[model samples]
Target: MSEGYQIRNQSAPHFLTFTVVDWVDVFTRKSCRDIVIESLKFCQKNKGMEIYGYVIMSNHIHMIIQSNDGNLSNLIKDFKSFVAKQILEEIESGGESRADWMLKRFEFAAQSNSRNSKYQFWRYGNHPEEVSSEKFLWTKLNYIHMNPVRAGIVNKASDYLYSSAANYVGGEGLIEFELPSNPIIDVLRKERFNFEIDEW
Candidate 1:
């Protein structure tokens, strides 16, 4: 992780990535992925976090988001903290077959980082990139939505249940997105989506 790539505009939508420590396949379990979904929904409804798009992959999650309250960093910290704690609890409760192995890895990761006390579930730094232009916004959205397809997990982006592509295609994802205007995404919402997805 590099330094100085902070979220400059909390009110603006930014592309964010939260990768699991050591690129672990923690999200291969539906329960772990659901923990992320629950957290996103909580952020959207309670923390003023607006989710424009998102995807939960094996070892990482990507989101196109903004904080309506202009405290994006704080909101993200809380989300990560809560999800990490809950997932750690789940693993500790013994249903996870890889519990010992995963806990050891997370423990080692935490030992290397002064910020963490017990374990490090997600890697530090969300790698936020502010959405500066409509083209760039749409490009990132397309990239985020198409991730599972590129990874061979799904044939079409919209087919993935844990993604905002479902929202773009008129189906409901885990979180509701605030309608954005003055961007190509507006045209995308109007003409390109409507249950018929364009290949990006």
Candidate 2:
């Protein structure tokens, strides 16, 4: 683990990233993406997860998340475990065209850690950054929304279907999430001296 990436404040909202083992592009598949979505929904419904923003890319995912029960660590652990199990099952059932290759990579990743016996789908450590201020929150939100645009996946952030960008602009998203207050966003806009969309 890195020096600053640990989840220091469990109850506070944190910007988090989850990467696939070996950076494999497993999420390129719709079924793989849905597994992540369904896992998040399960967490929200049964585990007190409060999602503010999220974006699922081809190989990684980012989100602004907090736990209603102040057990962010455990919630994240369970979420990853469940998602990994589901994804691995899909691969075993021959749902993925690259299943053999991906499974081999996952198996190799598991060898380094005794915790995972057969596979290690997600990389360890979430690289959690606590949302310490409204400005920081806005910054992460912009980064999350702009990810697809930066990757050339879409012409506009809100056009990305696997992100919360649409929800920010009054359009429905694939999953429900809490929105940052308009007043705070307004304040940030007014306070910006030289904010640039390209920078995000």
Best by TM-score: 2
Q: Estimate the overall C-alpha local distance difference test score of candidate 1.
A: 0.84
Predicted candidate 2 versus true structure: per-residue lDDT over 82-156, tens digit per residue: 998998999899878898999999999999999889888989888999999888988788889889988999987
* TM-score of candidate 1 against the unseen true structure: 0.89
Taking all chains together, the TM-score of candidate 2 against the true structure is 0.92
Alpha-carbon RMSD of each model: 3.2, 2.6
The regions of model 1 sitting more than 4 angstroms off are 181-200
